[model samples]
Target: MAKGKVGKTVGSLGDYLKEQRVGARLSLRQLADQAGVSNPYLSQIERGLRKPSAEVLQQIAKALRISAEQLYIRAGILSPDDGVGGSVELAILSDTGLTERQKQSLLDVYASFLALNAADGADDATPAGAENDAEGTAPITTEIDPDSDNRVTNEG
Candidate 1:
């Protein structure tokens, strides 16, 4: 890829992280402290001037109460289709210190989590009733056919 494209992707990821931090009511110093990274280094990462390692990404995700895979996707280190479980498992398996048994255990746990989430989503999407259950609960339905570009219906 071109350098400009890479820079743009990095900048976009940085912007997203900054927005998330602000939304969580956290200051740069607070996030830095929580992530166990230097304020200047975190600032640099937030500005897209520095690329953080997977470990640093995990630390930031933990501090933000989010999945590190999500951060990895935003940073272009992983794709959205890879999913959190797969990406995290792959990252852990790549670590030099982890044994094969440990990697397998982690992968199994991640797979179970993904399966549970998928099952929950499937249950929600099933037609429980014609309308939503309650004020806070609603059924989500998407009509877009992935195989066809003409499936999109623009509601004016």
Candidate 2:
């Protein structure tokens, strides 16, 4: 790894690398050999003591048979734009049936939907004022009568 301004090593990136290596059933030495890095260096990376370069990460990704973009994301070198539709987005991008403009529109809409869902979840979390509420309301519950299946009852 060429020297760069090494900020704090990203813990998620280290964890991801370790997990991938283990999932592939590759020893630390084997991964280092395949990735053209040192065993000690790889060990440091896995332990979150060192941050590997993007090229090194790409090589590691290749050795693990995983997407380089995934490693880049874990390393915090790249932002995740695809969200849950990663493979779908890749397919859409490569599809010859759609024009570039059409593809762009589709991707934009998809990303917007993900963003909206995330925002909705954020709002669903405890609100600022509600966190200080001394009197809490009981959660509503609904149940069906076991004896008569058609009967419904609501309780709080």
TM-score of each: 0.55, 0.48
What candidate 2 gets wrong by more than 4 Å, as runs, is 1-9, 81-156
What is the clash count for each candidate, in the order shown? 0, 0
Question: All candidates' lDDT scores?
Answer: 0.76, 0.74
What tens digits encode model 2's per-residue C-alpha lDDT throughout 82-136?
A: 5553775656555678775686677668768868878977879765356445466
Q: On a 0 to 100 scale, what is the lDDT of residue 50 in model 1?
A: 82
lDDT of candidate 1 over 2-70, digit per residue (tens): 777768877887888898899889999999999999999988888998877667887899899987777
Q: Which pairs in model 2 have colliding backbones?
A: none
